[model samples]
Target: MSEIPGLRSAAGEQQGRQIPPASLARLTIYLRALNSLLAEGIERVSSDELAEAAGVNSPMLRKDLSYLGSYGTRGVGYDVQYLNSQISTALGLSQDWRVAIVGAGNLGRALAGYSGFQSRGFEVVALFDADQLIVGTEVGWLRVSPVQDLATVLGRTRANMAVLAVPAGVAQSLCDELVDAGITSILSFAPVVLQIPDHVQLRKVDMATELQILAYHAQRAQDPDLESGPRARAAQ
Candidate 1:
């Protein structure tokens, strides 16, 4: 909530424009809260109430919202519908984005079958895998194609984004292939760090990392003083 003094820099400012990651992430929370408000037929919301619903502080929420321009009223707060639209527009969710899934394993198959993608303006157009046994197989309404056919599928489907669900060892190769195939965005599930171009956007979802985080919480729950010596060993 502290003032971001250099936020609104001059046109010729030497410093790079930096928007806080927390502020950017809060847009998603705002969208969800606004959606809930819309479902409940609520038209307007105060900063304090919206922040509480989004599990964030009011000043922080106000500062984040300010980056999108002045949409809040002096006393009445913000118009729920308008604010929702603004956030969606800022996140580039106003239009449908085509997505392809590489590696048609259980995780990939599940992603291809997920209904949430459609609701979020992401359409799964193709599924790819190197395994011949799984290739040509049907997953939901889409057919799994050979990994060699990735370029062809990308060209045919015009997908700008791809989801990599391959194993850790093969994830890098798959990512390279996707980049070569003109994919600008990648959502990888494997537990490997990828080398990608500056123009490419890579998002990783490591289940192992999530499990480790959960394990940490579980360990702490078993022994609150786990940070110290004997307690930590006991917690483990």
Candidate 2:
């Protein structure tokens, strides 16, 4: 069987510096594109072709890749497998990162059941909630544990990252708890902002806010009478 593609942990240091988030995102996109090419039996690809696959222009792709010190051969193009591995290394996908979800409500349950996280080297080892009734219940082959067991579960599982899916009221306190438990990375789904230690890294997913932004763009498209419309320009 072919070897499974692994990723380097983003928690790693490169040149004693942290990799930028934008670079990390693009690296993942590039990795996916390269993997597709490899699966197609394509060994080499020009920057232009690869960029198109990654949904970016050639120059932009080259600039992004330059951050990793990757330069393709002058005329032969880049080796697909080599570039993919390099990007995986830069994004820290080569190592598995155990994840713990702190909420067992709807969103938490959905996240726990998602298979993509595990496929990408993130294993959801611990699932937690505050309700006594919810605790000890199974959610996708794993039993939901009480939030009170967080510290022990974190230590026993050595979980370095966590997901905060609890209510907005409880998010911050639980976030603090996660930081205290030695979890350095977190993905927060709460509608409100969470305060954590300066050393902790956080990413928030606000579906409502995102949908509002999308709605604005969609409204503008439907009504060219907005600022972007020629009619609006004449009125101004």
Best by lDDT: 1
Model 1 weakest lDDT span, ten residues long: 1-10
Q: Per-residue lDDT tens digits of candidate 1, residues 1-236? A: 11122324322232134547878888888888998999999888999999999988899899998776666777678888777876787677877799999989899999999987876789999999899999989999999899998899899999978999989999898899899998999999999999999999998898889899889878788785636555433311
TM-score on alpha carbons, each prediction = 0.83, 0.84
- Expressed as tens digits, the lDDT of each residue in 1-236 for candidate 2 is 23322335432324345557676777788887887888899988999999889887889788787777544676667878777767776677788899999999999999999987876678999999999999999999789988999999899988888999988998999999999889999999999988877899999999999889778767876885636434432110
TM-score of 1: 0.83
Model 2, position 30: C-alpha lDDT score: 84
lDDT of each: 0.83, 0.82
Q: List the residue pairs that clash in candidate 2.
A: 7-92, 7-93, 7-94, 8-92, 8-93, 8-94, 9-92
Q: What CA root-mean-square deviation does each model show from the true structure?
A: 6.4, 5.6
lDDT, model 1: 0.83
